[model samples]
Target: MSRRDFIYTLSATGAALSLGACSADGGSAIRFGYIADYNGASLLAIADKQGLWKKHDLTVEPKVFVNGPVQIQALGTGNLDYGYIGPGALWQPASGKATIVAINTLAYADRVIARPGINSMRDLKGKKVGVPEGTSGEMVLNLALQQAGMTMKDISKVAMDAPTIVSAFASGQIDGAGIWYPLIDTIKEKVPKMKEVASTEDMHDHIFPTVFVSAAKGKAERDRKVMKVLQEANDWRAAHPKESIALTAKLLKADEAKVAADAAHVKTMTTAELVAKTKDGTVDKWLDGMSDVFVRTGQLKKSPDPSTFYAGDLYTKAAAR
Candidate 1:
């Protein structure tokens, strides 16, 4: 079946199974899906390990996925009540299969790295560039190309996951890659000559927000409570940075120093700050920009209406609690 058809089927299946998806605690212990790439979802990992979810009267069943789009597909099929996803993989929102509830981390985590001798985006022409299709890596690469007066058509696109991309770059299978940390860090360590040609850090207006999303039936009052707990967890991290980094490194099975460095790339907001940002149109503006980038990259035929997918009211109500 076509991708769109598959997504439609998943949504229909989820709607049919919605009645049984919730648990006894008003759906507090909902199934959560996340990527294991050691990004902002580490906050969720911290919450799970630190008993923050339990503190908020919630139980969680954490599911790990290879990438955001796959996890989002599960979310559409009733396999997950909540998911932590990047904006580029949120095509489900355009189709009315899910709604973004809260922003987890906003930062400059995505990067485009070039193998030595190809130092600029313009030098990428005719070169093999690796990225996980339908993820933020691809989106960022497209933006980088646009900035250089080029497009995906200018390069030999290689679809691969971050770790595989690292291997490919090391083996000379691909000349460059657009990937996110801590995987980008891995590539840099493995290939000392790799040059970071572009990054979200250079695109200040183009923020990378790892957001929390829920299926239609998953957006219950209990789910809001869960988000509130996530806000509380962010507050805890801010107050206890050392402990948070140690715990995150343990959960990710990554180097403590690497985790600490990764932590610096992302900024988590408090409940009040989340509410204020969403209310002041900042979130909408960012979503609009994200949609444009997706469309420009041929990921979407046209941009979806930001209002349809963004549930700012969810964050507003969660913060009010």
Candidate 2:
């Protein structure tokens, strides 16, 4: 097979991923930076609550950021040994320099809620929608519109975070809004007229949701130990749900009740499941679908090789033993 094709093939099977020629010998302490938002924060919480670092013979320091962009910037600066973030946020940085190492969470928890009178995406035309511009919600909104044969230009894309979106949506500043849960739940309860119109689930398959990526040059890439630790952490979280939720609440400053509710919605897969699904037809379908949407929405210049951005070996080796 050609080099690119070979890489894609191996990535599909979870084997023979390309790695730099250095050893990851001494880097045992890993600094995992994440966002305070639900998804990113949950990952760190899972690791800590499950004692994943101890299980893997490593020390993990989790740092919280405000958003995906800031988290990606931290990765690029060597401030983070690893992190979880929305796949949409990685487009610019991955194209520029960074490399995504593993698929952390394949299922996206983002949901779109529209006011009662607004039933279909067609109704969104000329309506105001709240989303953090250049975020996963915004990207998903673009895709949802495309699926309906529409575009962002068809509606007003208002820039706001989840909290602001919640408040504005309540006051009718926006006709529709996109946010993740418990916010989605909270908003729906507060605005009884609001209803869910679309969700990441409606898109059909995993859109890589949020991924685990490292900088072009981080110890996670060079050290097998670091990779093993991360894998063990994944395994731990897969085994411990309650503790993970509690830790998640502490870090997010959210209620334990809501944190538990969110945990049910977050389907954290094992390293083995990730390796298998990503290796076969599953990951191919996701990447192809994502590429189509990105190209359609002008998010990408051209179709670049998605496999080039992945390091399948770490996940592969972790799964092997």
Candidate 3:
């Protein structure tokens, strides 16, 4: 069967099989995948569960992935229309393949937790630190090390995903780590001696998770739709933080307190407000800080200009709306 025939067959099969199919404008449908380890990233869940996409004339079939890299890979391959996730996974795509449509949530919501005997950054030297490679958690940890006049070389770095890092910590294989909620909260509760030593605080305006909504292949126009959906969702979140928290927490299977804490960490910004902040070079300062940490630690070959990767069309449209 041809690709079109296959899509039709699949859509029919979904309808017949009782699984929902993608909904699109005037007969167009789009697949939108999300990560299930929601934590505070469940803004999409709230929008989805409440049928917000339908109100926008969209048939976004939301699927869940296990991690950011997988979710982003799906986005890059045309398997997803759009999703909310951290910008760290956008580096390669931002180089040429895709553009970040908008900022989602920017909260440091990430912190570094150390073992009982590890009391300071100085104590971390020669100790093992576990982090999911290429994640904001790791990025924050790298920044913290640099701020303390140290590098990853000063400590043994264990590259693993969130679950693995947690397991390693539990097994006493890693001395400390930079982690996000609810795992961060879970770890603290489970490990009596584990303590948070630092967070994304004092990083200037860089304290929130900058979510990216990527465009599908040959779908630049759809980027506008993604942005609109995100803007509406953000507005909903702002007006109903409690409802957002309850719904998101239910979907993520996390506690209300943890979800609320995560929400509190996010100082939501309007698209226009974010652009204005960028105009004043606050984003530049944040990226510069990120670049400095990467360059100093050899994560980046050189400090590239931050502006090369940003796309403001979505923000511009959202502002106009």
Residue-wise C-alpha lDDT for candidate 1, range 20-40, written one tens digit per residue? 333446753477776654454
Best by lDDT: 1
Output the number of the TM-score-best candidate. 1
How far does residue 36 in candidate 3 sit from its true spot (Å)? 4.4
What does candidate 2's lDDT look like per residue over 1-321, in tens digits?
A: 211111112123211111212223344456665654445666555555555555555666555443466666777777776766675665654464566666666646677779989998888889999987556777778777877788889998888865678779888889997666656766766688787777877776446456666776645434465556556667766787677667666655566776676556566788778788767857556666666666666766765566666666555775676
Better of 1 and 3 by TM-score: 1
Off by over 4 Å in 1: 1-29
RMSD of each: 7.2, 10.2, 7.3
Q: Which stretches of candidate 3 lie over 4 Å from their true place?
A: 1-19, 26-29, 36-40, 87-90, 205-208, 215-218, 275-292, 302-308
User: After superposition, which runs of candidate 2 have C-alpha atoms over 4 Å from their true positions?
Assistant: 1-30, 54-58, 205-208, 220-223
Count clashing residue pairs per candidate: 1, 3, 8
By summed lDDT, the worst window of 10 consecutive residues in model 3 runs over: 1-10
- On TM-score, the stronger of 1 and 2 is 1
Candidate 1 colliding pairs = 29-59
Residue 291's lDDT in candidate 1: 76
